[model samples]
Target: MDKNNNAVELRNVEMHFNMNKEKLYSLKEYFIKFMKRELRFERFIALQDISFDIKKGDVFGILGLNGSGKSTTLKLISGILSPTKGQIKTYGTIAPLIELGAGFDMDLTARENIYLNGSVLGYSKRYMDERFDDIVEFSEMQDFLDTPMKNYSSGMVARVGFAIATMTTPDILIVDEILSVGDFHFQQKCEERINKMIDGGTTVIIVSHSIDQIERLCKNCVWLENGKIKMIGDAKEVCDAYKKS
Candidate 1:
């Protein structure tokens, strides 16, 4: 692929999380130790030497087991987390459906959350005003729009989240295990919308545990194991190797 055609470029990316050596039971204990400068931390490396390129309009799959850094990679690409070492460059606008309800206030009504979440995603009030009805229609939560989001079930929240995130077609869409939350029917609807976005030339990076889903949706795949790239190639080839391992 041509370098200029790439939507995302990650070069030797490394992420490190600093974990406390000892867990403090309370704020008082934590503050006491902090004043004394006796607190100790252990560094945990989540990803190491990760390098990959996702071309514009490419449907890319990030495959890995639990704690293998797949979600971390998506977070990095979404600009939610920065690499401890190396460089990450993204070419265009991004819509991230990483954590459902993450941008919402549980106390707020679903209708209120539409504007709130839209703002978080960088959409202007005027833009949201124009798309509000469409968002409500797509989510199928018109009746519950006035109700507090905390009262809605997980599936309902997922529906609203997916609807709001996909309200506008972004240049790059990042999905992390969101399809696993909703019911089968809603999942299908979400898939169809995603397919429409993909057909419109939106680059998508999806992190899914389901090999079947990855194979069906993604053309290119990357397998991450123990924070390192194990394989990167055709989706079917990588998924087949992952299943065998």
Candidate 2:
């Protein structure tokens, strides 16, 4: 495929995590083990030679069971983590809603967090100032603006995160199951916003346990199992196969 036409490309990607074999209670004990060369590690593979391509303006879904490395893949694409092996190339700016409230300060009010999260997402203070009202409106949390995020419910937090992340249309949007936290009505609102972004030419990568949602929003889907690609192709076909299995 043409490079310019693709929004994301992953080639032979692999992710490995090292698990410590022993726990030390203190720095002194940890130093003793290091001096003795007694530190041991076990390697766990999270993704194995995974390869895929997402074209510009496409809504792609990653379907997998728990521990299937779907979240790992998204982290790699978002540059939150590096793959142990292989290359990932992305075109355009990214807005990641992978972890709700990851950029929030619990002690800060919701009003304060909007700018905080906006800065983390690469927007300047002046830019966030311009969009503050729009963000608050979309979040429907104007009443709670002065309330600390720590006091907000999970769903409320998710709403703020979603609002900030989608306040502007990015070239690529990555979402990871956060929509499930919202009530049915809010989820609908979010889905509509996502759909609008897609129509405006944003490429979206979503990881969801909801097969119905994957089929409804994604044109192409990949099924991951045991850190490998189990199936990839048209969303309906792949999802149907996964359902049967």
Candidate 3:
């Protein structure tokens, strides 16, 4: 890697989706049209020629309205979904807390699910074992550790999920709409943990509509509109621009 290269980079990336054309053709014509028309399927553009870079230790905030592709942008960065065109590069490990309980198995007990979630985040079983107590204490699920995750309440599940996602100190952390999940006290604790990670030089990318939280937590921000870059600068300036319009 070049000395000046960023930790995260996107070079003119684009993402698009194709709609089904099954209903548009007859049974016999379907076979005939499948080979010819499938290549020309109707395209819906989700991201358009987007490009950005984040250096090490940069707390990058993504601010956009609903359907502005904020979540999709995070997905791209985390490698959950690939861009149709262009290039995306990340130097270090990424921990994406994109959705609450995303990798969880409802049928599994909380203790078992801890191992599963940690594995999904790229940690070995031994590593999870070492951090097991910290995870359980942070989640406050000591009483329900043996219970199946499906039996837990939404708030309880959020606690476990958030704790599992943050078990390992990742080099890059991507959070999407996670701050509004748990109770006020839990939210405060999570915020403190995230701040500690940032202080330790972790690159953080936050996708949220809460202008106040973004302003308080982020130093730099990017505004995305209609799958394109709208603004990129200081957090307050970009957030103020987003709130007014």
Q: Tens digits of per-residue lDDT for model 2 on 14-79?
A: 999987886576999889889999887789999999999999999999999999999999999999
On a 0 to 1 TM-score scale, where does candidate 1 land against the true structure? 0.93
- Candidate 3: list runs displaced more than 4 Å: 21-40
Which tens-of-lDDT digit does each residue in 136-160 have in candidate 1?
A: 9999998999999999998999899
**Which TM-score value belongs to model 2?**
0.95
Q: Estimate each model's TM-score.
A: 0.93, 0.95, 0.92
lDDT of each: 0.94, 0.93, 0.89
* Candidates sorted on lDDT, descending: 1, 2, 3
Give the worst 10-residue stretch by lDDT in candidate 3. Answer: 19-28
Q: Which 10-residue span in candidate 2 carries the lowest summed lDDT?
A: 17-26
State each model's C-alpha RMSD to the native.
2.3, 1.8, 2.5
lDDT of 3 at 49: 89
- Give per-residue CA lDDT, model 3, range 101-147, as digits (tens): 88889999999999998888778999989999999999999999999
When sorted by TM-score, best at the front, the candidate numbers are 2, 1, 3
Clashing pairs in 3: none
lDDT of 1: 0.94
